[model samples]
Target: MTTARGDSPADETGGLTRVLVADDQALVRAGFVALLDAQDDIEVVGEADNGEEAVRLTRQLIPDVVLMDIRMPILDGLGATRTIAGEPGLAGVRVVILTTFELDEYVFEALRSGATGFLVKHTEPADLLRAIRVVAAGDALLSPGVTRRLVAQFASHAKQPASGADLAELTDRERDVMTLVAEGLTNAEIAGRLYLSPATARTHVSRILLKLGARDRTQLVVIAYESGLVRPGWQ
Candidate 1:
């Protein structure tokens, strides 16, 4: 799990992280691999030219991060991400989508489909690496510019009542937790807001996730907004 530099998986796994590059373009995939591999701690475990292959390798390798390209020849990154995130065996295989168009609609769908985050294809190498590391640790990477735009888009287009009102199943404390989550507060921050311990906040978030059938905080945010619980100017 270490790189050729003798950096152990823990060093890179926490500091460096393992990555899987899935891009239809050979050159882009190769370039990403090279960039990631050059880092002292990172290890590139596998590559995929299409979504199906990406899903197959992800289950097999269980990489810490997947750099999934938005556009592809067969199944696109969104479909592949859905498949990967939906799979039970690769629970911690976070996906960071690679995009060509800035602020594209597919980007939002990718988030809904369970991508931990995304990066513009031309993103700075350091930023991309940091995103991989963040997502690998189970935190979401919400690019501010993209996040604002996406939130605005969701506000405008999240017209359909969510598929179901799983929220009705939540307790009062869970509702409060969901609101804070939708407002973009992390676990510790939510703990501070509610005057509860971090452990309590994490437990509430977990219960909300299970009860509401959400994939992650990103989806919870969507549910909060779409439900009209978290208003535009409230936070």
Candidate 2:
């Protein structure tokens, strides 16, 4: 079921991050809506009780981000994520999975399903807002801690070895940036380390994502490790 809510005036938010809260629990949905509504830069545009409704409202409202719960009645978050990801029109939309468990298997699957990131339910409200902004800005929510856990979980499941041609496509500077990105450095850190402006660092990252066909920074990290561009002990 989807909750119909009045659309907040755009001028009120000054180009706010329109969000759809998707969870099965009424209280949980209400809590998220209230928290987000309190922020001047974010607005709760709609609420969905299941994955199906989430996907439906997402197509209709075309929000900037979705705070999606992993467990839902009709369709799980992963399915909704995949559906959204597969739609070219939804490219500007990002999904952030909300879960109670930090290292659940679904976390990995959610990434593959096109989630920008996963946040544990107990995350601080400030961090939650920051994650939304990060994802909405076309960056993945892969903090160092999250990257460490993900690498530890998926290291053994590396895909087919990346060919030398994969490395050949990146320039030396781009490769350097890739390594730092793999190490979970944010654009700000990378900028400081490489003596580049933050905008330049972000441009390099965006190019890397495009050239490597990675969905986000998390996949970039996986490519770095699995491709032997960065080794397990390097970081």
lDDT of 2 by residue, 129-227 (tens): 898888888764546667556765765574543222377789999999999988888899999999999999999999998887776786677667767
lDDT of 2 at 71: 97
* TM-score per model over all chains: 0.84, 0.85
Clashes of 2: 0
Best by lDDT: 2
Q: For all candidates, what are the clash counts?
A: 2, 0
Candidate 1 per-residue lDDT, tens place, 1-235, comes to 1112233333335545778889988988888989988987788877888887888777766778889998886788989998887878776778888898757778777777777777899999898877777777777435744654575566557445533657779999999998888767889989999999999999999888888777777778767777777776666
lDDT value, candidate 1, whole model: 0.76
The positional error of residue 219 in candidate 1, measured at the CA in angstroms, is 1.9
Local distance difference test, each candidate = 0.76, 0.81
